[model samples]
Target: MAILSETPELPKAAVSPQALVGAASPLWAYFGGAAATGLAWWWMTRFTPQNLEAMFETAAVAPLKAVEVAEDAVVEEIAAPLQAAAELVPAVTSGTIEAAETVEPVMGGEAAPLGPVAAELIREEEAVQAAATPVRPRRTPPVPPSSDT
Candidate 1:
């Protein structure tokens, strides 16, 4: 295969106007954000006593306290029907069934509790684990093979 000529100039890449983007962003954006943040902080301080100077300013938080009281009333109102329905329905759990079943015999002839049966099963499983004594396929003190010239 023949190589291409070096005189052929490569096409120029498209460029973004980053300076125009930066210039288009107004100074008011930062000042507006700062002003909004300051207002929010002031509002928060009105609700919470930040220092000894703020302890006297409890009147503004009264409206927020009223809102909290209304929220509790609304929650009780919303949950009333759900609470009534929950009381009417049964709450049978899986643990209840498991506890009931655990009293029955796991093995033949004699009945056993869950604790002893689980312990016996675990003890039996250890033998299966011990039979393997798992070995990893790795170079254990690798030796060089003898080579003939």
Candidate 2:
């Protein structure tokens, strides 16, 4: 009775590769994939900087680059004479030194040495300033009030 109660097992059915395809129709699936690709392309184009920097072809870009270099050359040509004139100007001129002047220390710090011309100029300046200022008379003690008053 136990053997009869146990049913015989049936063989498993074989599956073909074709049976693994998605349930959606082929046309709809293809269209959905194409739509997704198109959407990604549109999003990239819309969000990217001015459609990816206005791409230039070699033929058109080469001429513009040449013009830029020519412009730089023109500017340098125009500045040459001015630069030559500036170079001819001297930074220091000769001056006769009459006497030496001591350089005062700044903020109680160590004093710095001055060139002969600078010292002479400083001495002349000090002399001029001294001559321009009027000398004040020495103050005398006030006279004591008279005892008789």
Candidate 3:
């Protein structure tokens, strides 16, 4: 006669990779979907049409304003030196002309008279005028018809 055990040994449940994955997949999907839905709902509640429009306008206008400011700054940076140069041009021109007028003419190791300078200036003016004039193409007379066709 064998002694009878008070409680039978229970079988252990086997956890497999496929079963674990199958069990966890739906749970993960459910939580992911719930989180996505909650986020969407929150987003919809938080941002009304007016709020969205305002946000879009802010997003659009900020960069444009920044670009405009940058453009203005660049233009100012570039224009300052150009403006200074432009301002100096007339002064430089007048100074050059005055210096040219005050310069003593020297030629052939002697002080030359003003007459030659005046004549040279006249010749330069004539040359400038000739250069400014447009040149026309010369026309050639038509050849006579050959006697033997």
RMSD of each: 19.2, 24.3, 23.9
Q: How large an RMSD does model 2 have?
A: 24.3
* Residue ranges of candidate 2 with Cα displaced over 4 Å: 1-112
Clashes of 1: 0
Ranking by TM-score: 3, 2, 1
The model with the greatest lDDT is 3
Q: Write the per-residue lDDT of candidate 1 for residues 1-149, one digit (tens) a residue.
A: 23566467778755445533554656668878999999999988889545864655676787899999999999999898999998999778999898888897666776665698898899889988988798768968868787975
Most accurate candidate by TM-score: 3
lDDT by residue for model 2 (27-49), tens: 67787899999999999888846
Winner of 2 and 3 under TM-score: 3
Model 1, CA-based lDDT: 0.80
**Which run of 10 residues does model 2 get worst, by summed lDDT?**
93-102
Cα lDDT for residue 118, candidate 1: 92
Runs off by more than 4 Å, candidate 3: 1-50, 82-149
Which 10 consecutive positions of candidate 3 have the poorest summed lDDT? 1-10
Candidate 3 residue 36 Cα shift, in angstroms, is 6.8
Cα error, candidate 3, residue 67 (Å): 1.5
